[model samples]
Target: MTRSAPVPAPAVREMDIDGEVTLFHEPTQTALVLNETAGDVWRLVDGERTADDIVRLLASSYGAGPDDVRGGVEAALAQLAAHHVVDLPSPG
Candidate 1:
C-alpha cells in the first residue's frame, strides 16, 4: 500500500532566513523552526512527492546515503505533522 504524499498546510506563513525556515501556523497560533535540511524538504511538499522522493532528493543534493537521508526527512516530516505545519494522509 502506497502512502499519500504529505501536503503543507495552506494556512502556514513561512520565512526563510539563512538556510532555516520559520513557519507560523495561523489556526493553531504556533511558530515552528526548521533547519536547513528540513526547510528543503518542506519546499518539496507540494502534495505531489512521496516520502521516498523526499529522501532521494535530499540524498542526491547532499551526497548522503539514502539511509542517512530517510530518517532525518521522516523525523522532520513527523515534527511538521505534529505541529500542524503539514498534513500527513494515511493510506486507505
Candidate 2:
C-alpha cells in the first residue's frame, strides 16, 4: 500500500490583473487562476490538512453534496500535483 505524505503549504504569490487573479509559484512556473468556488477551496490548503480532509471541509463549507466536492477536490489536487504546486496523498 502507498502511504500518504504530509501535504506541504504552498509557496504562493498572486497578481491581480484588473479584476482577475492568478497565483504564481516560482519553482514550477505554474500559474493558477481560481474561479470563485475553487478559490474558496484553495484557501483551505494550509499544510496541516490532508486532501481527504479538504474534501470534507469543502462539502460542508460550500453546501456541496459529498460526491461533487470529492470529485472536484480530487481533480483539482491532481492538477496541482501535476504542476508541482501540491503533493498527492498515497493510498496508505
Candidate 3:
C-alpha cells in the first residue's frame, strides 16, 4: 500500500526571507525558523511527495548520494512535525 505524503499544517503561515523560512502557527503562538536546508525541505512538503521522495529530490538537486542526505532530511521533517508545521504519517 502507498503511504500518504506529509503536508504542512493549514494554520501555519510561512515566510521566506533571504532563502530562509519562518513558520508561525497563530493558534499556538509558536514560530520556527528554518535554515536553507530545512527551508528547502519545507518547500517540498506539498502533500504529494513522500518523505523518501523528498530525500531523493534533495539528493539529486545537490548531486549527493541519497544515503548521505537521508538522515538530515528525516531530521528536518521531525523538527517540522514537532513544531506542528507539518503532519507526518504515524508509524504502523
Indicate which candidate wins on lDDT: 3
Instruction: Kindly report the root-mean-square deviation of model 2 from the true structure over all alpha carbons.
Output: 3.1
* Clash numbers, per candidate: 0, 1, 0
Candidates sorted by TM-score, best first: 3, 1, 2
Which residue runs of candidate 3 sit more than 4 Å off their true CA positions?
1-3
> How does each model score on TM-score?
0.88, 0.69, 0.91
- 1-92, model 2: which lDDT tens digit per residue? 55354353367676776655567878767788866655655666666677778888889887887788887887776666665666666664
How does residue 68 of candidate 1 score in lDDT?
87
lDDT value, residue 72 of candidate 3:
90
The top-ranked prediction according to TM-score is: 3
lDDT of 3 by residue, 1-92 (tens): 54478899999999876666899998899889998789999999999999899999999999999999999999999999999999997565
> If both were scored by lDDT, which would come out higher, candidate 2 or candidate 3?
3
C-alpha lDDT of candidate 2 relative to the true structure: 0.68
Cα-based lDDT at residue 92, candidate 2: 48
lDDT of 1 by residue, 32-86 (tens): 9888778888988889999899899889999999998898899989989999999
Measured with C-alpha atoms, the lDDT of residue 51 in candidate 2 is 70
